[model samples]
Target: MADKSSNASKKSFKNIDDTQSYVHHLVWLDKNIENYTNQQKLNQWHELDDNIKLFSHEEECINYIQKQNDKNTESYIIFIISDSCSEQVIPKIHNCLCILAIFILTTNSENCQILNYPKIRATCLDTSDLFNRIRHCIYRDEASIGFSLLNKQDSTDAEPISLETKSNEQYPIRNLQEDQARFLWFYKCHNFMIELEDDDRQAKEEMISYFRIKYNKDKRILKPIDEFEKESLQDNAKNAIWWYSHNTIMFRSMNEALVSGHISTIYSYRYIIKLLCRQLKTLHKEYKKSISNNRLHLYRGQRLKLSLILLISNHINDLISLNSFVSTTLEEDVAKKFCLGRSKNNDEAVIFEIDIDLNSEQNIPFADIRDVSRYPEEEEILISIGSVFRIISVNFDEEKELYRIHLTLSQHEQLIVNKYIEQTFATEIDSDDQSILFGKLLFDMGEFEFAIKYFENRIRCLSDHNNHYRPTYLNNTGVCYNQIGDKDRALKYYKKASDIYKETKNQRGLGACYHNIASYYYDKGDYDTALRWALKALNERQQYQLEKASTLDLLGCIHLAQRDAEAARNNLQEALRIRVKYLSQLNTNHPDIGISYFNLGKLDSKLSSLIDAQNNYSRAEQIFRHNYPKTHPLITEVTQCLEQIKRQL
Candidate 1:
């Protein structure tokens, strides 16, 4: 039975290629570690000394060790095994570990007949511990004598080493493999290291006691642990318990930081998520392997959960990165707006509930909802306002702290809806304020259909009562409809808005309405009519330099469509100049800036200045990538244009 077990162990590890197998064993050994020295801890030691190597995973450690073995140099290694170590790799690579130990042990053996041991630290020790012990044996005993004893024993017996042998028996050696016996020595050393830590603590305590006695007698050479010294002691004490529930502590800290508005804590949470992503990716590779073997049942559910976590982590990082640009005061204002909905005059509060998705809901609880009148009539009541969520149910789940309401938006819509609730709700609002907000937020979120709905609602409310500001809402609604491809309805609304603007003698309103009309013509490929209206808009917007630049860009597009490169270049350059002047006041990643860059790039492309075109297109791409989701139309458009430029080059 002993011979058979030895033969099986040999067969199991005989085919290992190299040190990679040892990495596999180490990875497997640390699979179920509850606490780890996090990467952040390792980072603190980085650059302190060149001899220290820190690795986040096993493969890197293996490669580093292989290099060190080649140089035959003494160095330190810190390995951070992530949470994904378990249920992924198995311990089938024990042979390489033995081989590596043998290489270390036999170093300089040809000259001195003695072996030297290399220092290795990992999360855990397994069968490889025996190999380490063999190295230690060569160091402890006389080199030549040790070699002779091993050689004589090997020549005298065909039997494998037995772990249970007694000194009086013929084969007194342990009935274990040569490599397995070394584990005993490794266990002894590990226990000794633990004892050293305890001993050091006790020695420090004794020295402090002696100092206190001396201070009591001579009043010198001894001082109490001050507050600073006490803090240092407490920090050192925590090192003992650092691993216990560290992951749980990270999540709790993140939650506290988020609630307390600590930006640094939010950043730390992002880093933690990034690390988890790396761990999950490693586990996912194992899951794929299990699938090919028809053993996916073992990990399919776990894989699904990990994938969900990875997805959420990516989204959260994106949100936090975007929010870093917003001011703290602005964030507070937005929070207040969403937390204080308006109350109705009938003594009933307007309960605003946001349906996040099919599986989840959230109620917006307002602490002090005040009744506000929109129209002059006291009977008219406005319940709620936002571009994102429509009321499905007002029911609140007091017990669960979540509202069980169905969201009417799709997945993408829900994301933008939540974003609007977070970013744009930074000011007090009433029913009349809804029209402007709904148009702006929905337009910004790329929800043109919903934007038009709110704009039309606002227009209807004003037109029904003969409000003089009806034309402005009409023009805004026309822009939204035009964005959604309802060209005929867009034209009708534009004409009505144009007529009303003329009646009111609102030059700015007329210019903006004319630009929309010109935009419609441009989309229809009627460059002549588009150019005519664009020029009219430009002329009226000349006094408003900011608005004038936009009209100039539109004119440039119209000219470019007509194949007039020179005119397009002139108009686009002027627009770019105007945009640059206001760059400091505007969001650096404003969509309009990207559009201007894109238009300039297009004109340069038409002129066959591929280098200039590429540069401009690159600028546009950067802005679009930074400001919008990857799938946004503007980003997609810029990507397509950049690809075309690459082809042209």
Candidate 2:
């Protein structure tokens, strides 16, 4: 089995010789990774690190690990087996980790890519005894929280991230593929809103501890017991009891996080689904015998996992839907809008239901609803439902689980009726948000692995929306493909967008597509072709008075490439002028403006405007020095230009 697994992994890698795969990516392994103290770990990994030949991209690595659920997969094995380690044996892996840590930071929440890799800190050793209790409080399933060693260290040991310091603290979590260092970036921007007195520090810390305990509970897990080789009936009971408590905590934590308005750790959700996987395997393991109803508590774990999964899905709608439950009259009006009624006898046999309670204390009975149509095949529900739901009353009830689904039907405009309501309802669900979000979220997060699907769906949706929306859709599709490094497909979409915009005479859209295509050519070092397209884009932008500053800068770059010193000075100077006029006032603290100024200075020097060029270059150097890292190449470029200009003076 071990050999088969090793070979299976090897089969996933055959292109190690590709130059694109080794863009000088550094792999620093920690030497102090308990049980990983070999001399190779001490030095940069050389010849022996070829075992990890699975993926080239970060997204591929994520998907690869997710597919592996076998009980045999070992963490930190890559540290020993992969060729990434074979590249160099840095005298220290810790030295590498220290430098790498500084670059990992979050700009906003959700879908942003994180840079820090934490393979070891996500520990399998569930040392905190209270973790189970916290898990029960957060999730309705215990097995959702597992324990396993997360020993993916390089030659240098990386530091573990500290847990949150506030009990009521909210963490905006991105997708699970993001390591913990990247995950914490989401919480940086939001101004957390909570009302507490000045002396509430201890209380806030306690609140943070509650979440920390649950959050720290492990994701990937090892087997449940080491002494299982001699397990008896006594051990079964203990395991069942422990798992039940964990499930209970997992349920509560997830639900509270949803309603509390904090971004959630996607790890918790993945952990729950994986718990379902484990439950299936356990059921198969116990299939031959009939132990007790308590053993079925194992299935109970899976059930809890599934429910919380559903709960999270529902929360997006529930949270975004807003407070509308004012009066029954409002519900009637909203229902009237979505009623696509038939004429005369209405022999079409339309079936629907709306459950509205005239009873007092109208809470979120609207949310308890899982579905909205009596028809089993519900495809176009969210749009249809949302169009009408936006006008109605939706509020929480005394029993938090119960919700009212209000429906109404009309025979053309002549006849109408409401039916089947005892204050609770069920309808077959139709989902659309998942499809819409699939491409958008993944693309935004730099996880291009999944964006292709969603972009396709969104394009189809926009095409169906109206003729005017198609250009925007095409442009977005092009951007997604471009980010994923599929320049050919990106150009195809940009061309489509450009064609569509031409038909509509939408100059901005046309210019933007040209700009994208020009940038693509520029990056490929096709100077003449890139310059031609960039000029074309500029002409299009000026024809419509579009935001031409960025386009102008590109045009300037093209002239510089052509070595047209006179034309380059004119274009680059104009581009810098436009940026200075519009950018700061527009509230864009554009650090790239410094680069543009430096470019203009170079053009001036080539045109023999040395003194004027020196000032421009000096300003560019100062701006780049202030806004960007001291080591950034832009600073060096500006410095060299300024120095050369000074020497001429």
Candidate 3:
């Protein structure tokens, strides 16, 4: 037999428990079962009839997981727990979707705590509301962590099901109704995991054998798509939405197949590179056509073409580096499709230095004074940082083992005239005049500590003066503190900035500070305070459409937290309208616009506006489809929402 450690190193399962083909069974234990063996615990809930493996200890289970190195091997987890200890243990193993939690509890009140976990379905020896709630949860499709979608049938429901405890706050569980359908179906077959006193042994074995076959039939048949097939689909793709769905599914299948050591997956990925190259070529042609037709002056058209070219280039680079262990054949085949950073015969070449004078069109030649030698010696030229140059030729030097690059000013295009001036002793500094430019630059670059230092220096330079820049610096410093997770410090800075902005009558600054404060309170679950500040920020930001839209979105969230559906819908819809308008003006869809639509969709779904919700969800899906990869949370979220909506319709 092969060494277990060596086998573990070869396996590459991307998401083990996430695949729907896997089965999840919940096993429960009495809170008093203190020192039972793993087998004893499992035996208390499940019958030992099928091929299911059981381990007594967590370490033994982990080792078992490590040894299942074969790509085709199935993955699953079992949690044997009592009611009291479940909350502590479940969250640790919650990431494994294939795992099932069996809660050994008898009362409906105890079952309420388990409702916070969507994937968990409890079965007691005695009858309880747990079964009925499971049916209701499934019917509503609320098995995921998020707000429950509104259903008219639930009008008489007393209160919104709060997932966490009132006394000790914890993460809320989103109820996914779709999960109910699957779990309910599975449960009806097996009835319960724990063997009952009146249970028939022969019948239990039959049920176990029946479930194993049912699980295998549930697996989705995914196949790797070839380059020609993908190209054909791309050509037929009506819009970005079409491409998004196709690429997402195709890549996911390819990923799964590749991780399993499938040789054909490499060919599919190679085809993806070809497609990217084709896209780049098309963009290049459009750019050239625009230039020839004298239409390059159209900024949007030029920008679009350039953006597409850059996007394609980025995709190509990403694909090439995706797998470090790519076979030699695949690497060589992909390399043949592109020509870059390689030697080409020179039509004409020359070496020259930059002519710094703005009025001069000609460059200066480097001093070459080796007339006695077979070839003239090359002279080194010094230039400041950010100086632009054009390469004419690149010749390899045999003696130095380096490529001697030749360049000239006229051969290549220059995007910008460098304007960087070195900060040195020669440049005089004025201490009294405060400037936040360095601080702002550092903040933009994410150097928060250095940015804080610069902001402090600016404040010191001002000698405690109340200037226009002071509030801006304070507000930005607060933003840095918030990003670095020092909420107390962030709130303090925001308060100071707010005071300064109000004193100076700086509406924009005050609005931003209010928004920051609202965000802080929101994080702390102080919805009332968040709502108050959000309203103020929104009122102040009426003239700033984008910022106003953001504030409106925040207001929508606060309203949702307060369980005021009508107010949430109004705020989210307004945010969506403004975001849509913004994107329309730019003639492009943005991820933020998609998020606005998604928020509106969630609110609409909650109000039982199924058609409106579906429409908004479709639009959000389309936007996310084009802008982000399939794995992006937004894309998956919208996709999942759409699936639930479809079932409802």
- The full ranking of all candidates by TM-score, starting with the best, is 1, 2, 3
Q: Where does the lowest 10-residue lDDT sum fall in candidate 2?
A: 415-424
Task: Quote the lDDT for 277 in model 1.
Answer: 27
**Model 3 agreement with the true structure over 267-315: per-residue lDDT tens digits:** 2232332232233333334434333332111000000111112222222
Better of 1 and 3 by lDDT: 3
What digit string (tens of lDDT, one per residue) describes model 1 on residues 1-649? Answer: 1222222222222232211001111211233232332565334223222233334455655555455445533221222232243112112222122222121111122432221222121112322332333322222111110000011112212343222323332211112112211222211222222233323333345434543554565321222222212434335343211211121233334333333222223323333222222333333344334433321110000001111122222221121111111111112222121112111111111122222232332221111111221111111111110112222332323432222222232121223212223332332122234335445544554556756765675565553656466776777778778777888799898889899789878888888889989999999999999999999999888887767889999999999999888888899989988877765244554556778999999888888899999999988876654444344567678778889989999
- Candidate 2 lDDT over 603-624, as tens digits, reads 7787788987898787776554
- Candidate 2 TM-score versus the reference: 0.33
Residue 85 lDDT (model 1) = 35
**lDDT, ranked from best to worst:** 3, 1, 2
TM accuracy, model 1: 0.38
For every model in order, what is the number of clashing pairs?
10, 61, 16
The per-model lDDT (C-alpha) reads 0.41, 0.37, 0.42
